[model samples]
Target: MSSSLLIALILLLSLLAYWLGCRRAVTLAQRPSADKLHSRPGYYGVLAGLWCGLPALLIVAVWHLAADPLLTRMAMHGVAAAKGVASPDQVDLLVNDMRNLVAGNVVAHEVDPLIQAAADQYVGLQRLGDLALAAVALATALGGAYVLLGRIRPALRARNQVERIVEIVLTLCSTFAVFVTVGIVLSVLFESIRFFQQIAPADFLFGLKWSPQMAIRADQAGSSGSFGAIPVLTGTFLISGIAMAIAVPLGLMSAIYLSEYAGPRFRAVVKPLLEILAGVPTVVYGFFAALVVAPAIRDLGGLAGLSVASESALAAGLVMGIMIIPFVSSLSDDVINAVPQSLRDGSYGLGATKSETIKLVVLPAALPGIVGSILLAVSRAIGETMIVVMAAGLAANLTFNPLQAVTTVTVQIVTLLVGDQEFDSPKTLAAFALGMLLFVVTLALNVAALYVVRKYREEYE
Candidate 1:
């Protein structure tokens, strides 16, 4: 049976166990007296389900984790005995070919009888492993259910035991998340180190050029790749700055008007419409920017006797700002509304007008949240790829002029890593270096934002 089907059977059995456990506990409490069961029937049922399912799931997980490596070893032995000794790369290629043969994919090289035998062995072993896994998991689950059902009694501390299991599961989930994040950072850091080994850190960081094409063959042109990132960095900052300039004021003002000044009827009508902007796909926004906004900007600039590229940072930034508007407005509106109404009343009692109360007291109290909202908008702007790629041309221009075409770090990272390329090459590894730089900058921004929020957060009694 398939593992998924087996797992589904285990879960069905667990549900049966849960029902049986509940029925047993209720049967034990037939004589309803003042002194009754220690734990509730629901707790007993949960405990039974946990006992029946968790062990079976663990068995399934262990088998899955071990099966691939064991099969690979067996396949490797058969191939080696047939093909003689081989290097690591050759072994990998042979294993890949075996896998292709097993999967019915066309093999790159000529196939032999030994390779066909190895492929057949791989398939047979996989089927045998699946059968073994199903038998073991079912037996373990049945045994766990029998033992736990036998132990179910009026005095069993089922609630405490179930709570402990829940806590452990939650802790494991949290630890898994932390480890996954650390793993990503470490993977990027290692690849970035490899990239830096080929390109000098100073040259990569401070150089004015941004070309990353390196010729693979001797006769190929443009063998020398420029690893300079200054232009890319400047373009990213310029576009982000323009986006923030457009987003912050409009979003903040919209939030302020919606939260404080607008009446319930108007807010009820407009707020959902405003938030709908967030749900619009970014590709849709990119299309809008490229087709509509870019043309309009080019025409307007021409009328004004100014030179503006058809694909300019200005168009991308404007559309990106519009896209991020809902983020800022929604968050700021919630924060503004969260400010205690008593503060406004106190300001009014001190002869302050509504605007005065808002500007002097309410905004001060909500400044931290407002700043956080703005920072979120800025991060969104920085990480944007599609709108910038479509509206702003993918030129890593150093100039800060919004009328010119520009690109971002994410765009360059995408450009460098899009095609099939060797991971060890500087051209491909540069993507990881760019990714590491973006990660570090984002981390610093988060740290600074946290410091600002904590340093200035109002302590209201």
Candidate 2:
């Protein structure tokens, strides 16, 4: 009676219900005195299937959601009453241990007889609950199918019911997505508020140094960490700027050539090959940046008598730019293709050359989309963690020199939260602050890009 097994059984029963309903509808249609069937046979089948499945799935979801807490409460109550464990915190700990033991996960505390008994009880309760759940779900599915099949007459409006169910499902999915996004933003915002309470917002935002190492013990020799974000933010923008510099020109030019000049066969073959770079894992790009690009940049810098760190911003930015080129080129190519041929035809009729037509007409029409693609590429570059971590050394130096080593905000976030961390500490909470900063920065970028797009779109219109 595992949940997956119950779901499969319910689906199978729904399929049977669909077949029966369709046959019933077909039989009704064949009657000499029956009016034309209200809807298609498929609609009748679908309506029956929905009736059979939806109630059973709802029961299954509610059962699982309520079962674990109820079982935990029942088990914990017995343990507390028998053992006189009155403290709330200790009860919580014991509950966790019992659940962990039941789940076969390692428990923090050594298992005692009381915990063992409670775990066994929890398992027994879970098994009994699963059995009940299976029985109820199956009966409900069968009952729903029977009711719906009996009601499936010529005027039943099966199609309308099915469409309504689908619309409700889609609305629920959209709402769930919005809630998840809001949840993420609120969680990060709350943690960042906690972090800012510990470290002054001014110091965190405007301080020059980026050290986040806080001494655990008062007597420890380490300096209390400086949460200055300036260096980190500088490095982020530096690398992202370099990446955009490389990505935009090359990606846009390649896109223009492919869309406007290249032959159909060449464009078809080369575009996929170009887009394959996007499909390659970021880690692979990281490795290539670290092994191949970094050394090459350093060697070239040496030949030019310039100082280049072994892991420099230039190397990471260059590789990141190459990795994101497909994001820009593929999207730009599509946007360019989407530009109506009438614009180009009008330009040609006005005696404009191909280059003039593209510059004045095609590109203007596609400007908004091109800007969107660049914005996406910029976001990709900003949020890239693996390539920056691999190629750029983790030094928060406030320098604009691409030859020097620097680190990004994403790298800092990952570094700060790498291991087990007490969330209350400013050191750990700093990760949330950095995340919030990134979120805000990206939002600002989107707003700016949108403004540019709207302005240009109005001009063209």
Candidate 3:
């Protein structure tokens, strides 16, 4: 069974068990002071449900995760040994084929008797596993309920115990979010460390070239690809520059108009209209960039006596800017609206025009938020992939010109990993290294933005 289906089945059964348990517990004996119970009957039902599902879910999760990989490995090893395969790597390929067969993903014409046998074995084990899981789960839930029932005497602090259990479960669930982030960061860090073992981290960070290709055939000497990230970062900055050029003025002005100038009726309409820019799918933006925006820019540049590549950084950046504008304006608009009414009145009372008061008082007061929003935009631009892939050229040209074709780290990472490349190859490793760089850059931007917002924020009236 799929993990999700397993979970759903377990939950459905647990809920049913909980209701039955709750009914049994409540009717076990009628208390004269039943109304004096610490919690309502529904809370008791929820408590029963929690006890039934939570521990069993935890046990199942731990067991499946720890054992599934081991089982798969043993199966692969057994199949390999049976096939008399000498190279472990060759065995792994056969194992993949076997898995595909079991999944029914392989075409019928290609299905051999060996593959069919493996698939049958896989399906058999899955059925046994499901049956075992169901029996164990039901038994555990009943056992827990029976024990809890005996303890639920009139004097027992059942509510307190249930609440404590809930607190622990909630804490564990929340910590998974932190764990996921740390896990990703650590994986990238370690892989990047491995990559740096092959190439100097300094060269990767600051060198002026970024051709990540390595030869596939064993004795073919060719141009050594430099890991200098200057071009990718240069292109990243160029794209960001063009995006910011498009986003900042437009977004900030929109915010100023929305917050300080627009009346309520206008605000109601314009805010969502501005935010609608954010709802457009990034892939749609990518298509627009490739089909419409890039060609228009090239033609426009040609008319203006400037050479423009059809897949220029400007087009992607501009489209990305449009994507980021809502992020900037919405955040800045909130901060602007949060400014003290008294300050605006004071500025106006000093014989300042509405424009002067807004420019001087409101904008400066909300400047920190604006800066944060801009930093967010910058990070978004750096990490953007689809638009750059479709619109920005693949050439890792270290050019400052927005009209020129250039590439970013995300685009390079995509090109490096896609297709049937060996995982141990430099081409694949380059992606991990680029990912580390991207992580560091975004991390720095986030930290700076948070610091700026915190430092300048008017926290109290």
Question: Tens digits of per-residue lDDT for model 3 on 214-249?
Answer: 776689776667789999999988898889888999
- lDDT at 61, model 3: 79
Full-model lDDT, candidate 3: 0.81
User: Per-residue lDDT tens digits of candidate 1, residues 1-461?
Assistant: 99889999999989999999999888888866734889999899889999999999999999889988789788668567567746888888788888888889974567777778888899999999999899999999999999999999888999999999999999999999999999999999999999999999999899999888898667788658898989998999898998888888999999999999999999999999999999999999999999999999999999999999999999999999899999899999999999999999999999999999989998889999999998888888889999999999888888988999988999999998897887978999999999999998888888888988999898776
Q: lDDT scores for all predictions? A: 0.91, 0.93, 0.81
Q: Which RMSD does model 1 reach against the true structure?
A: 2.2
| Residue-level lDDT for 39 in candidate 2 | 94
Clashing pairs in 1: none
Candidate ordering by lDDT (highest first): 2, 1, 3
Which candidate has the top score in TM-score?
Answer: 2
* Arranged by TM-score, best first: 2, 1, 3
Question: For model 2, where is the 10-residue window of minimal lDDT?
Answer: 452-461
Stronger candidate by TM-score (2 vs 3): 2
Q: Best lDDT goes to which candidate?
A: 2
The digit string of per-residue lDDT tens for model 2 on 269-300 reads 99999999999999999999999999999899
Q: Which runs in model 3 stand beyond 4 Å of their true positions?
A: 1-6, 13-35, 39-42, 70-87, 106-119, 142-163, 340-357
Model 2's lDDT to the true fold? 0.93
